[model samples]
Target: MPAPCHRTPSIKMVRGDITEQSVDAIVNAANSSLLGGGGVDGAIHRKGGSAVLAECRALRAAHYGRGLPTGQAVATTAGRLPARWVIHTVGPVHSRTEDRSTLLAACHTNSLRVADSLGAATVAFPAISTGIFHWPITDAAPIAIAAVLDTPTSVQEVRFVLFDDAAYEVFTQTWREWKQ
Candidate 1:
């Protein structure tokens, strides 16, 4: 049997790949180009099929070169996953000069804004920038959690789906502290 719904405006952290998750929507850490690339981008594209790319192509044609400033987001159909929508947000790559915290916060905020625009009640998020972007899971977790908690939307549930044990542990530990 399925687990009971907690029925609260709370964030839940779980260990798993975002592609395999069943939720209202999944957050895609996309490149500015919006084309499928490595890590979460590749996984979502691979599972969601070419249709997603086709749709993105259309969107890019209309909105390309406009520059979707960091932290802003757009939505498209899920294509293949059990979700109804895919919310794409751009995240920052770790660098010596960039404000990593601000960019990471933007990622989380933009995702929530997209979900809210779509009237989504639940959403799943991968640890943005924790992979190839190298934002460091330890730093990303708290910023992500804070962004989700800070959103004013009526979104009923938010999930942090970690791709590995280290990411999961970081999120779980941070969540524990945030709750108390």
Candidate 2:
């Protein structure tokens, strides 16, 4: 493990559903299409309702017609969700042939920037890219923690919402080691 990363803001790790978090903003590990897909992306869109999708459509028509790029983050209304905003970011698929760690880190940093732009004080995030994207939790967790810690933002509370015991355990261990 690397040396502990010290951050000014408060970070919390919990095992829960990202969509249920009552924060100012929630991050969606969305596909590049910006349209709903499986896993976290699909759940968020399903739970947040049509208002969220409506804003997404507007974003697509105005700016992201070609789909959101990997590592870039965008904001949309939270709609019926407990949050005021949804920060959508596309995670890079893990590949043994190329180094894409920078893209993974950008997902967190860019999401935080978008959340800060919306004046969101509290933000919740899922274990991005660890799912169908195939990024190993061992590598992804540290990148996630470092990215959120290193980013300069107005966000006060950063909550990592891990979906399962394995994911939660990895994040918990990483968080402890990173804070050491």
* TM of each candidate vs. truth: 0.91, 0.95
> Model 2 compared with the native: what TM-score?
0.95
* Model 1 regions lying over 4 Å from their true place: 1-8
Write down the lDDT of every candidate, Cα atoms only: 0.82, 0.92
TM-score of 1: 0.91
Under the 3 Å rule for N, CA and C atoms, how many clashes does model 2 have?
0
Tens digits of per-residue lDDT for model 2, 4-104: 22445689998989989999999999998888999999999999999989989988999999999999999999999999999999999999999999999
**lDDT value, candidate 1, whole model:** 0.82
C-alpha RMSD of each candidate structure in angstroms: 4.9, 4.7
Colliding pairs, model 2: none
Q: What lDDT does model 2 reach?
A: 0.92
